[model samples]
Target: MVEQIVEVEAEAVAPIVFWSTENQPERAERTKGIIEGFTAETGIPVELVLVDENNIDSIMAANFAAGTLPDVAFFPLDFAAGWYAEGILDASAASSVVEALDATTFSEGSLALVDTPDGPTAVPSDGWGQFIVYRTDLFEELGLEPPTDFESIRTAAEALEEAGFIGIMSGTDPGQVFTQQTFEHFALANGVSLTDADGNVTLNTPEMVEVLDYYSKLMAEVGPKDTATFWDQSRALYFAGDVGMTVWSPFILDEMAGLRDSVLPSCDECADDPAFIAKNSAFVPAFSGPSGSEAQYGQVSYLGITTGANTEAAQTFVEYWLSDGYLDWLGVAAEGKFPMRRGTTENSTEYIDGWGNLEVGVDRRAPLSDFYSEEVLENIIQGANNIDRWGFTEGQGQLVSAIYSELVIPQAIADIIDGFLTPEDAAVQIQEQVEEIQAALATEE
Candidate 1:
């Protein structure tokens, strides 16, 4: 008989813990599914911890104090860089992972969000680009062409409003993500940027004021009366067939799926059923303003491994998640979630078509559908990268948020929009707040 020596096997280790905000159920589910799939293939177990986004600070603090930080974490873009700066994250190893990933696969703009001093600290999972989703059928009905500039957008809005529909749908309410809707579009239109070379704030220029003035006028005219109440309320109004056109991220395509099932049936039986979004909406690149300027777009979120994580395991996870196959799955699961890598195919077109078909007032047209469109994608990538080149460190993101929130910039903008204060007055108020913030930061430095 062969040597009958009994050998003991090593026990399997537990999978790394990954934490994320439970804000969007679908996103959470998609992430969970992917992780589970990875475990199934690799026999690696993963535990997911869902937390409220607002409570992340307390949770992270507690975890830090206890030396029990998660192996991997999904932090907001605004705070991630700062964490990296404080040595709370292992950026050097993270950079190696980014280097190993297919750099050419990602859009230049999207990759910039994750690029850090030590290296690319994270991989972007989701992001919002400035795009105009308009009613195509309505434009055709009114004999109007798609607008290429800000003035044309205004004209189109006026025409749509005259046809017994709200021209534009935007939520400009204070204490909301109104900046995403207003400042992004306005700044882009006027070619105004938030930061200049050398990482200095440069929003207090004549171009910025002009852009703000344009937004103020737009809010007073075509914007919904209740826009000041909420940012997403406009989405509801748009889906209800009351609004003709709107500017929103591609995620709106996903949200519209549920709305169509729940709301379309009821609307079909109503008197305006046929006329309600008769044609599917189409997305176009945002237009330029009178100054012939175009601003860089914004990045929404990114994914990275925590400094405390097992380096090899974290890299393996990041590689799997950033792979083309996984991105395709994510596109199907989340709809408008575009892939960061260029030349990668995804299931986004199907979702886009479905949402486009449901739109009543717009002709079904596809505009700049390619994620790598040079004119649009390239510029966006450049701007995003430029942010980092200018040294707008993660610390700056926190500083920006603090200044905006504490000084109540939103309220001041609202006042300007309401004509209660002049643009110059608002600018001065904003400048004073910026100076105060600078002084405080100087002391810390």
Candidate 2:
């Protein structure tokens, strides 16, 4: 018989292909470090690539079409569910990884963001809260309560506008998702469930009309006259002390504090204290809407193991991600990272309790515990539990998928605010467009 020598090391070794949409260089460098650590620990190499977040959808779709999909990808929950329906996600493998990681240790609400009717379409990673980041000094100086309601917001905006500053700064670009996200963040509080309990599209309801009217007014009166800016411009405007408030992801925390010099460039005022802008800012997690319930958007993202990937090594990476490698991952941007995996069964709450202690900023290390009160953090965490948007709550991910891909609602909002149509007319037009999108998607399937 021929010599049967088993090469165990060569047989076991497999390189993981990870496509990350972390475009920022500073952040990407830190992420690379974590991957390096993983390689050292596991002896499994990772082929890492930095993808453009703006064009990730097209890139991923093209890769899939060519049968060249990567082993893993950092996918946002916003569009993952729709992809799941196309049988593009490996839910079976992802669900098993979740179970191995200890499901209870992760945030139930965050997991629900990625959960499909079949099961979790992607493995839950980390998430952040969406809320209003406003001027603390201005609010305190004017004796204005938090912008938790429409009336207070209007009052604050008017006062700030008179002081020779923009009252509000939100993304209004017609083509960008920022405007749609801003609209959802604001309307969710107004009780504008874009879809009803049975997953029916209800974008043309009276409540949505009210939401659009208010949004248009805010844009016309308080927002930047340009109405063409998105996150970077809006963030610069706020940190430079030219705007009163902005609605954005919690990722603003570190940038507001001047952690990454590459993005959210430091203002002249920040020369004295790097975290000056962060200290002067006030955060309002969510506001009580007409529905009497304060709703906050939980923008959860996942490290999904792509279908047809090397499942064993992919599973290994995920287990490491949720366990030993987790702290380092969150440490890269601790300011915004709310722990999705709270802890393991051995030490429940361990990760969460340590999360607050994670320091922020480049020159200084200030714990989040010191930055915001425990009560405030608790309230924000509570909001994470109720996180649901139009297509997110019901099994209507397709409706949301269509709404975003087609820019149906964003166009309607732009039309009304830019004087192309009235609120009622815009609503009618959007409804008609959504119907067309549904038909197109159905035909494509």
Candidate 3:
């Protein structure tokens, strides 16, 4: 539980009140280290308030109502546009910081995702793309191709099942956001979008229907019998060599390599070497489907200067965050925190190069490069700039927020898997429900 401070005592010259959602002890320590460096260089003291990611929205709302929103907030992409719409974010301040830092240095894709007619809704800091990680050793023995697309994935899953092994482990818990993210990744590969340019619901399209059918059939055939399986189950099953493939975030890199004691690889080959699975695993950073183009579902965090911010100080801190303090920030969880600001114009790949060498892992520390090859590293870094989501660019961020908050897609998926609805019917159900949500939001306005 987050400690509730009823009031923030003000200094003669107020410290920059920064709200950060990375509440883990290690992550909070790393954040403090960066803030210390910032103060040493710029003499701008910052009070770091660690906010739980799950509680951020409600906390921010309460703060907004009380006129106590922090000077700066490190928050998730899902809230970026919605907060901006609610007049909580100071877009002009965020945009000015981006401009002052040289906008070209940032990942164009990151910037594009939050771009508004006015300017950026927030400064894109860092993010990770979802990955399809498979057992290369098993694939080699079974003569299966990498699971890069729908058909290839299906083929590999079926082959694994026929060989008396579990085919895949992916999120299935309808109540969890991981399920939404997992399904969205597959849907994006199949050219699924929440809406078109004019903000119309597009979930009932043929493409969506095809994706639903493919996903439901594939999961029903080779996935776990229980629908409660989620990220933890998927990762644990993969580490145990019980599943041929698992879709996961890059944060699993260290844990897979046995550097993290709590979740080290426990495969048969790992009896002698915990890194066995890490050595023989292959990753697909981005992939395409028969109906759609190549894409990866990405989640980015942003630094928003709130409407109640100490503007000049907030901008300065943001610039410091994306510049001098950037690598230190990324080093906290290098595997997941891919740099949204790649590097300075002078050294085009400076931060990327530095990030590759930064040490990761908890029980044992080593750079990700020590485990993953240069080619594998490049796939993750390069793919950072090619991410997609449901509706940020379509002026439908509010709708996307509504969809996630209600677990709309996950509900439809659960119904399909339970035989209560066909993929075709699920598509229409999703469309009508989302349309109603969009309409309700419009009415509230």
**TM-score versus the correct structure, for each prediction:** 0.79, 0.88, 0.97
Q: Estimate the lDDT of model 1.
A: 0.57
Instruction: List model 3 lDDT by residue over 259-361, tens digit each.
Output: 9999989888898998898899979988888999888998999999999999999999999998999999999899899999999979989999999999999
Please give the distance, in angstroms, between residue 63's alpha carbon in candidate 3 and its true position after superposition.
Answer: 0.7
Candidate 1 lDDT tens digits, 37-114: 777666666767776766675677677667777777766566565566545566766666657764554556555655
Model 3 stretches with alpha carbons more than 4 Å out: 1-12
| TM-score ranking of the models | 3, 2, 1
- Best of the candidates, lDDT: 3
Whole-model lDDT values for every prediction:
0.57, 0.75, 0.88
Ranking by lDDT: 3, 2, 1
- Model 1 per-residue lDDT at 126: 48
Question: Which parts of model 1 have CA positions greater than 4 angstroms off?
Answer: 1-11, 22-29, 226-229, 257-278, 343-395, 403-407, 442-445
Task: Evaluate model 1: give its TM-score.
Answer: 0.79
Candidate 2 lDDT score relative to the true structure: 0.75
